[model samples]
Target: MKLTETTFQDGTPVDGYGPGFFRIGGQRYEGAVLVLPGQVAAWGGYEDTAPLIAAAGDVDVILVGTGAMMTHLPPAFRSALEQAGIGVEQMASEQACRTYNVLLGEGRRVALALLPA
Candidate 1:
């Protein structure tokens, strides 16, 4: 599956990562969106970098989830996102993914901000 296009501020098309897709906001991302956990680790470590980078692609809202269990988006990570001009929201990884799915289903352009396990 792929991150399909959805109606949102960005108005850009969403592309999927691979099989077993997870839709957030309105975009579909499969597998792990945090393809390069090491590259931007300092931004806030693994807990913050993943979703921030993934949202860089073509997403309107990047809902960041700091960890596998219910977690919070680190303060530093939020600052980076604010500077990047990407609107961000916070939620758990599981919740973020589920929200992404709903946004996708609703034709909303959103991306999942998650921390890799």
Candidate 2:
């Protein structure tokens, strides 16, 4: 049998999450957050599309964490990203964090736009 450590070369993985916060790398972020390769910042939820759109060239897809449960993205929100050539995936906050870490470990270009969970 073989085992290997999950290494995130380009960015940090989600360490933990609960209630209304997420701990990444070793830092705790409150409220909504935008997690991009090698960068993490506060996000203004759905209305804040500039940051996400600006990240289009850096990422292929974005995993959107819609609080504690999965929910459909607003039509305009989805459209804006798609128009910018960025794919969007909607899921619960917990799932999004897990998926983001996995993808990051694989060296895929991905980001996270998360609401509180």
Candidate 3:
């Protein structure tokens, strides 16, 4: 088997993540984070959908990392995003990170709202 490295020309890809933190661009972020094409910001969990909403026109989808487990987001939250005309996909945080990287590499207009595992 052979391995090929993943590159990020937009800004940075999530370098690593475990337990309660994620690493990107050599910086560590504790708790949740909102990752865009060329930016990453602290996310306030379910309560903080404003940032995502603000980027609705800029992104095609938002991948939500629901910590260590795959769970559903609140109905209101989901509805709000739907109302903004943005797509939402939820899964375990780790998977979300991987998916985000893959989508980003393809140059998709995607965002990641990740909760620490």
Q: Say which candidate scores most in lDDT.
A: 2
What tens-digit string does per-residue lDDT give for candidate 1 at 83-115? 777777876556665566567557665655455
- Candidate 3: residue 84 Cα off by (Å): 0.6
Write down the lDDT of every candidate, Cα atoms only: 0.51, 0.94, 0.88
Considering TM-score, where higher is better, how would the candidates rank from best to worst? 2, 3, 1
Q: What TM-score should be assigned to candidate 2? A: 0.96
lDDT of 3: 0.88
Q: Candidate 3's residue-wise lDDT over 1-117, tens digit each?
A: 999877777546788899999997788999999897678889988989898999988899999999999998999999999999999999999999899889878778889999998
CA-only RMSD, every prediction: 8.3, 0.9, 1.4
Off by over 4 Å in 1: 1-32, 35-57
lDDT for model 1: 0.51
- Model 2 local distance difference test score: 0.94
Residue pairs in candidate 3 whose N, alpha carbon or C atoms collide under 3 angstroms: none
Model 2 misplaced regions, further than 4 Å: none
Q: Between the candidate structures 2 and 3, which one is better when assessed by TM-score?
A: 2
Preferred candidate (lDDT higher): 1 or 3:
3
Of candidate 3, the 10-residue stretch with the lowest lDDT total is: 5-14
Candidate 1 C-alpha error for residue 46, in Å: 4.3
